[model samples]
Target: MDAIREWLAGHKREVIRFAVLFMFLAVCLFGLGRLISGNTAETDTESLQLDETYLAASSVESDQTPVQPQESGPAQEIIIVDIKGAVKNPGVYQAEADMRVIDIIDLAGGLSETADADTVNLSQRVTDQMVIYIPAVGEAAERPIAVPENNLTEQEIGNEEAGTEKVDINTADAVLLQTLNGIGGKKAALIIAYREENGSFQTIEEIMEVSGIGEKTFEGFKNLITVGAK
Candidate 1:
């Protein structure tokens, strides 16, 4: 018993030293675990912040983008006209409403040097599908003198009552001639060409001399037309 007591007293200091070493190792392991947990929490917070920043940037881009506007439809209405004869260019042309004969003549490249401007009413308002004819110089003199609107003699009024108001073939413009039955732009042009080439018609039947007009066609409008004072 006395020997056992002496050995225990000598080893007590070594046991105490071993116990202190074990406690130090436990403290180090606990500190490392706490550090790992803190780092994981920080990493998650940084990832969430990055996601929020990306979302905010995307929202800003969406807001800053521009929207496009829509286009309108075509024009409402259009006026179409045919300009022929002594203009620089002769063909169909598009014109606006309220446009005058002079405006359209200009659009057709204006009158040629041979054009008899006085033969046409330049200030007349244009209409859709209207035909404008410009005569060459000296041609107007062959046309019957257009009776003044205000001073009509009794014979002239009697002439209007005698039949369908007879168109003076010698004086009629292409448009005025077209009012006759079966007369169109082509036939009207031929009539003017004949007049310009052959001088004024000596009789209404002379219209058949123009190409495309035959005896049958002339007979149809014969009573409705006159050659005026030959």
Candidate 2:
């Protein structure tokens, strides 16, 4: 037992040296593993931060973007008028404001063969809701006299009482002349023709030179007619 003890005592230092070296290696390995784990955690944290930043930038861009507006439509314009008597077609029609009487007549299929074209003011401008009446050749003879207005002005009423405010024969058209008592379309036209041929009348008696306006007809309208100076 003493011999064996002597042998262990001799080898104790060597064994102790080997144990210290093993402990040092184990400690180095543990420290290296801890360092690797810490580096991995830091990389994961950096990646998460980058993702959060991208999401925040995208949200700001969406908030700053401008929205578009919807578009709208246009409006339409139209007019209406009434045409009657002696036209090829007669009725109410839709028309434009720029249209003239001639344009409206064409839309109404133009005048009938019996229409007295001279009586119509073809060049006149058409208005909304206006009534256009194209008369036949002899229609004026049957037309009832235009009734005098009951709401006449004081001067007009006084003129009516005194048989004054005569229509000037030199300048009056057929329509204006027809307003006089017993003057129809035929007689009115003859008066105009005679005036155009012979120029302006010098006196009230000069109107009798027209074929249809005899002394009897002149006498009837003399108080309501005038020969205005040339």
Candidate 3:
């Protein structure tokens, strides 16, 4: 018994060292497992963050709106006239009631270089269906349209009142005014526009205010045209 006790005391230190080594290995394995678990949790957190970002982007796309265009308004009635002149295109033209003779000239592409307008008046009040006639250069003096008297003819002894050329100021648009001596629809239109914009003219000479009328032309038409409240 005394010999066995002596051997056990000698080997006690070696056995204690082996136990300490085993305990250190167990602690290292547990720390490794904890690190692995923490990595998995971080990966899951990143995956959740990616899913949230995708959902937000999708929501923004789905919530986008569209735009619409606006519509236009209604149209107004415009009075037009026919102009035959030394203009580029001597033909019918459409103009507003208050449109000036200049407007018709513009529509006709303006007068040719040979358009002799030295004595012709251009700015005259006009009406619907008026005709504007512009003479060419070197054209001799114009002949007057004779106002025939209401004399009884062979078939008109007891007939009703004969048709007379009465001028309708309100309805005498440019085209109609063009038919008058020394005036076209443009001048007529100017007259009409002036009368409309500034009220009726107090005197026939007041027609000078139109775009192209001069003293001589106004004097020629002084006794011809009238201005009505209409």
* TM-scores for every predicted model: 0.35, 0.31, 0.33
Q: lDDT tens digits, residues 12-62, model 3? A: 887789889999999999999999999999999999999999999999988
Whole-model lDDT for model 2 versus the true structure?
0.69
Alpha-carbon RMSD, each predicted model:
12.2, 17.7, 15.0
Q: Which candidate's TM-score is highest?
A: 1
- Stretches of candidate 2 off by over 4 Å are 1-160
Candidate 1 lDDT for residue 62: 91
Rank the candidate models, highest TM-score first: 1, 3, 2
CA lDDT of 9 in candidate 2? Answer: 90
Q: Which regions of candidate 1 deviate over 4 angstroms?
A: 1-163
Ordering by lDDT: 1, 2, 3
For residue 135, what is the lDDT in candidate 1?
71
Query: For model 2, how does the per-residue alpha-carbon lDDT over 1-230 read when each residue is reduced to its tens digit?
Result: 99988887999998789899999999999999999999999999999999999999999998895977866645434555556667899766777777778887899999999988887778776655455667778764332111121212222221222442568988988766765544665777888888889899888888888786666656555666777867
- The parts of candidate 3 lying over 4 Å away from their true place are 1-65, 75-79, 94-103, 116-230
How does candidate 1 score on lDDT?
Answer: 0.72
- lDDT of candidate 3 at residue 162, scale 0 to 100: 27
Top candidate by lDDT: 1
TM-score between model 1 and native? 0.35
lDDT of all the models against the reference?
0.72, 0.69, 0.61
